[model samples]
Target: MNSRNDRTDLVDTWNGKVEEWPKVRFGDVCEIVARQVDPKLDQYAKLPHISGVNIESGTGRLLFLNTAAEDKVTSNKYLFYSGDVLYSKLRPYLRKALAVDFQGVCSADMYPLRVDRDYLDPEFTAWLLISDSFTKYADGESRRARMPKLNREQLFNWTAQIPPLSKQKTINSYIKWQFDKYIRSRMAAKAQLEAAETLPAAYLRSIFQGPEAESWLILPLGEAGEISSGITLGRRVSDRETRPVPYLRVANVKDGHLDLSDVNEIDATEAEIEKLRLKSGDLLLTEGGDADKLGRGTFWEGQIPDCIHQNHIFRIRFDPSRFCHRFVAAQIASPYGKAYFLAHAKQTTGIATINQKVLSAFPLMVPPVREQKRIALMLDARRTEAERVHSALADRLKAIERLPASILSRAFIGAR
Candidate 1:
């Protein structure tokens, strides 16, 4: 990702492929290649100005929704129109810089250029840009490790093997067919994932929401969630490998349960482990925070036999008989819970902290335990299927990305 950020680089893999055919510089392709330079600032008009979001990998956004004055915006030097490719020349690891449609301004760091679409299929070229062979080189060659980048001069000079128009079109058609099929599969996956999340909420609402939403029992957080504190580790463990006690941090707690990645060992006596060791139903909450994270907590499914939560996280033990643990987990993940946490949170040294008082007083809703179990089961099944699609789409996207670089490898070197 670093190498691909700043410079125009040729991937050895793609280069090898291109060498098998007659090669030509990018300049020979068709025509029409240029970048815009204007609107020094305030380039974001009514149109959506792409930040990192415009990058496909970064989750592209077509609307520039921010109206605040404090948001930083890039100059118009990177403005692009539909069909033009705007790649993140900065870091190759971001692997995000790619085709952008919907005319708008972009970051100067991004290399935005109009290709000779007639000479080369724009779609075909997109696939090449995403190729691993080329991307890997760019990741290393483009920008510095911290911030990657690429420029126009090197990009224009990139060479590729030019097949006959007829041959090129045939190849494009095959790729397009595959892409079309992939798109349909991807759409289905998205639908499935959405269904997975929705079914749970619907299930809960069905069981709990009485006629006119007036009859179900509702209570504050005081009656629902029981608050328990995680142990304080004042001294850091010097030798993680030598330590026997597994410690949990905010990074390891995601969605629900303990994420193994954040688990670190600590020096603790048997007595300390007894007090700190987590039980099966304990929920983890953030006791501290950083700029990128709000310190919002997650659940630990008690996947491991024994592990401890750090001071930055709080242990929550809910009354499962009164409220379904799974439903409560989902509730905490809901938008309502997020607002409650953020609004009541106290900002100490720019870190949002949720105290035991507020934690115990929040309002909560619950559904019958039977329905909660059903909903959780249904959602898990759908989610699993959706995840499978997600994996496949990711693979297809990767394949499309590597095609152009593959073409280049053969064109420039005789290694295809």
Candidate 2:
């Protein structure tokens, strides 16, 4: 048996010497198995189902499995057997492909491939589809409509370079081993990132859960100050003379901070600016987009002068004498706040929204002014530390994600 390094060396030698390997069209080595099965049929209704959403990108690993009955799949699906390569034709750029070990019915948007065992290894064929070169080819050939997708003809007509069957096995085994190690490392980084993300929330919970809870007063947010929606933008420009003033949109408000990098100008009347203008200590919250962004908000420190917020954002003015705006922001971004928003928010199509009434009725935890400042200081420090860790872990995960492309490039073309 060849050692891993020995197999890698063999690949390097083959590529470096430009050894002649059989070049074949993808269709020559694989049969496009389009066994259609109506999921509504009693015979197939209870079979396990797979789709693009069920597989992770670039790893050929199944993320989830659901029965057709459980998923309530009513459309016609493609049947796949064990050891088949499942490739998603929808959005080829997502790079979703998997080698299944169980029989199932997949979405019509997927292609269940049957490999020619005498000529190609199934695992090798799956990995080949995940490579950058193949992804680029698929992207080029896919029809550019509302949803970019590859047709059967385009996929079958694509070409691939093949090594000997034994070499293919060796390379596939080596790639799998390398991928396993990479996955472990990436998972560890992701775990660390998740832990880092939860650190600030844990700290906030600790603070609120202390003896301070007994003395804390739960009051509606409207009790602190006035809450109002921002100015609404219309398709037609205002007839009144107006100038472009920097404005905050839902995109500008993040979980705990404002992103002003792409702030745009909106024409507003002087009275509209006066009524909707954001104050230095105003807290800006998004109305809704994603479910997680229901209560997401940040304090405005007057980054842009004379800036007004859009109608999609709610501007809350709090009495500085009683509450710290930063502390309010920290609380709203915490787990407890998220749960409250998730419960009260009206949800539709994965988007959750809160109206002015709901926003005004938000339960606010108020402590002594001095205590609020202290809590805000502690939370800010902890959040900064957690963000630093999260950023570093995110960068590491990105680099790990690029490793497969690097390895594939080396395996196909000689290392530069």
lDDT of 2 by residue, 256-306 (tens): 778889999988888888888888989888988789777989889988889
| Reference-based TM-score of each model | 0.53, 0.74
In terms of lDDT, model 1 sits at 0.57
Consecutive 10-residue window with the lowest summed lDDT within model 2: 407-416
Weakest ten-residue segment in model 1 by summed lDDT: 59-68
RMSD of each: 10.1, 4.9
Report the CA-based lDDT of candidate 2 relative to the real structure.
0.83
Highest TM-score: which candidate? 2
Assess the local accuracy of residue 35 in candidate 2 as a C-alpha lDDT between 0 and 100. Answer: 86
lDDT (Cα, 0-100) at 232 in candidate 1: 68
